[model samples]
Target: MFQNLAPAAVDPILSVAEAFRADPRPHKLDLGVGVYRDANGNTPVMTAVRYAEQQLAQTQTSKSYVGLGGNMRFSRVVTQLILGNAEPTGWFTMQTPGASGGLRLLADLIAASRPNATVWISDPSYVNHAPIMRAAGLRVASYPYLDVASGGLRREAFFEAVAGLGQDDVLLLHGCCHNPSGVDLEIDDWQQLASMVSQQGFLPFVDLAYQGFGDGLEQDAAGLRLLADASEEMLVVYSCSKHFGLYRERTGAALVKSAGSKQVQGKLFELARRSYTMPPDHGAEVVAMIIESAELTALWHSELYAMRQRVQSTRHQLADALSTNGMEAEYLCHHKGMFSMLPLSEASIARLRDDAAIYIVAGGRINLAGLAPNKIDTLAEAIVRLAA
Candidate 1:
């Protein structure tokens, strides 16, 4: 049995992390993974989360489970955060291991309900998206997204891809702060997508991982809300890892919206029962407490706002430095979120790693939030050398 096991390929992002950690260089920088880091390169727990945890530690009575659907309070709170004021007719929400788990769970549901459905992902999407969908036995398709050569989105190609979607297809979209490629849609583009969904009869699967990390929380959900209004059926995967700094806590939710008669909530509950039975309670309860308290909620908002501003500032600084160094990287300034794709080839990325001790995904996707502002010039110089 051991002899029959095949070797697995190392995940590109995790491989970058491993290489970055092993490097002995004094100034090595890692731009892999979308974990948010402060200006000092520290991933700090938000004050709100800390307060909630303290409260739970002091007054918690039991370590009992939260049941198949996890904490309903947490589910409602997360749902409200994603949907905002707009209330869809029939919607279902469930606590998941994480956004990754939520995505897989929804994929499983899609496989169960519509075995013939295809999941259309962005060409240069989060590396895990396609794999997760395919693992569920769903056919995967690609839509043109980032044009690395010119450092911009191929809007016409993207529109054509969306326009060609079939009724049994699900278009997977990055709600905000698109992973890998930080390129996000404008209001007009989202509106166009909503119209396409309405006309094409396809479902939208919105992945909302970095909500507050992108634009404002409310602004980030704009596209998802628009799609909810336009499309009768949708799937949303929400993650708390970045916004709440709860990476290891494994917290998130899977949301589904369908017709009133579909009993989607019951189906989601059954699915949760068969899968994990129940999600971990600590993180979800912590989030619920924070959301329930006005003061804690405000504090959470403040910290999230500061984090977003820091990432934005870093992006501007990086773009300016790259531009001054004669590199075409203005897209960094325009894109929102924790990650952005650099206009670098595989050879250029390798050169940066081998020669400059810099690490980024092979496709040049980098975590803009991971940069220390003071070191932006150094990173910019390395990129300029390799890209030039």
Candidate 2:
């Protein structure tokens, strides 16, 4: 049986990361991974998180497991953070290892309950979205999201695709800060989409991994809040990794909002119980402590704001560089958050990696946070020389 196992294909994102790590070039740049880095090109720990950790290390008394649902206080605080004023009487939630784990848990729930449902994701979305959904035995499909021709959102195509979604389908939307493509829906666009969700009986599944990295915490959540208000039922997966700089801590939550029934809550608990049993405690506990304290929460907001501004600044700078090179890249300036996709072919991406020693994902997705401010011009020159 062991001899019959076939080799699995390597994940493209991880493969790029591995290749970047093995390269010894002094000037090599990595723009593939989706982590927030400062102007100095480092993923720093937020002051609030650091303080929380110090507090936890010194005062904490136990290393015991945090139940299948993790910390209750964490669940309550994080759910409040995500849903804002939305009523929780109709919602079911669980603490997961990370947003990835939440996605898997939800996928398992979907597969177990509605095995025939087809989960639709954006054409160019987070690399792992489809895989995790498929791994949990759900069928995955794509809807148009990007316009490669103009290097912007394919809005009309998106509406057209969703219009075709049946009642049994599940639409996976990037709550904000769309991965791979930083293009996000406007308030009006979200309202229109919510109308579609109401008209067509499909489930609205939101993946909110970059809440504070976009326009603002409240601004980024506008779309999700709209959905919650408009739809009778919805699914959301929240991630604290990026905003909190808790990448290694693996903190996240999965939420469900539907009318009157504790059945969904029971299912979520059961699903989480079998997978990982429970999430890690340190990160969520830190998050809860910080959010619970007004002072710490204020500090966390300031740090989150600074991180957002840095990424936005890098975006503007890169856009300026591309414009100077005679490329139509003003769209990059408007796109928010850590990532934006360049309209580059596979050969151009290969050339960028091989000749320029600049690493980017095959689909031209680059993490704006990964670039140091000083290297903006250098990257621009490389793209101009190679891709232009």
Candidate 3:
């Protein structure tokens, strides 16, 4: 039975991380993985998270299952965080292992509801979006997004693609801090997309992984809320990994907004029951505690704000360093999140890895959060020397 089994395809992102670990260079730089690091190159737990864990340790009593929907309190808090003042009558939320699991669960629901439906993603979307959707037996297609030449949105081409979407299409979008590219849609752009989505009748599916890492918690969620306000039915997959520092906890949610929310919720619960059964409750409980308490929520917000500012500062530092080296990289400052794609070819990316000990993911994505400020000049020099 094992003889005919084929080798699994290597994950593009994880393989880069593995290669980074194997490299023997003492001065190697890893900007491949999309995790936030401080000035000392550490992914420290936030004060709020640590405090929440302590409180959970003292107050929590049992390890009983949290049922298929996981923590309803967590779901409610996350919904409020995402939708803000939107009416909650037609909304449903369920916990998942993480955004990845949430993505798969929702994909399964889409497949079950409409097997022929096509899920449209950004041309250069999150690496796993298409694979997960397709794994659930859904057709995946791409719409225009980033304009490589300008390091900005392909506005005209994007809208042109959106114009063709109809009832059978599910448009997947990055809520904020677009992965790999870091280019984000402005509020005006979201407004236009909402109008187009309302008129075109395609279901809007949003993946919000880096909510507070972009501008602020409220600012990052603005576009999603705008889209939510206009649409009667929508799908959202949210992650607490980035903002709540719950990466290992796999804390996330799948949210549905429809007139028949009860039916959709039942479908999601059934899908989830067949899979992981129930999401781990530890992280969700911790998040619920943090969000429920006003004091802890304030602390979390402050920490999130600091992380956002640090990433932004790193972007500016890199841009300034590149500018001083006579490279035009002002576009870096305009990018919203932890990632920004440098225009390097395959050969250049390999050269960066081989000659300079700099590990960047394929497609030139560098995690500004992973880069330390003191090493900015070295990175800028390498890019200028090797890119030319």
Q: Which prediction has the highest TM-score against the true structure?
A: 3
How would you encode candidate 1's per-residue C-alpha lDDT over 1-388 as one tens digit per residue? 5988889867989989999999999988888867888888899988999999999999999987777888889998998899984554688888999998899899988998899999999989998999899989999999999887766789999998888887899999999988888888888898999888888899899999999887799999988888888988889999999999999999999998887435766677777788788889889999999999999999999999899999999999998998899886777888888988887799999999999998999888889889999889999988898866
TM-score for each candidate, following the candidate numbering: 0.96, 0.97, 0.98
Writing each residue's lDDT as its tens digit, candidate 2 over 1-388 gives 6898889878878899999999999899999988877888888989999999999899999999888888888989888888884556677777899999999998998898789999999999999999999999899999999887777788888999999997789999998989989989899989998888888889999999999899888898888888887889889999999999999999999888877447887777778777688899999999999999999999999999988898899999999998898776988987888999998888888888999899999889999989999999999988988985
Candidate 1 residue spans exceeding 4 A from truth: 260-262
Candidate 3, residues 1-388: lDDT per residue as tens digits?
Answer: 7999899988889999999999999999999988889999999999999999999999898988889999999999999899994557689999999999999999999999999999999979899999999999999999999999999999999989999999999999999999979999999999998999889899999999999899888999999999998998999999999898889999999999899988998898889889999999999999999999999999998999999999999999999999999998999999998899999998999998999999998899999999999889999999989877
Candidate models: Cα lDDT each: 0.88, 0.89, 0.93
10 residues in a row with least lDDT, candidate 3: 81-90
How many residue pairs clash (N, CA or C atoms closer than 3 angstroms) in each of the candidate models, in the order given? Answer: 0, 0, 0
What TM-score quantifies how close candidate 3 is to the native fold? 0.98
Rank by TM-score (best first): 3, 2, 1
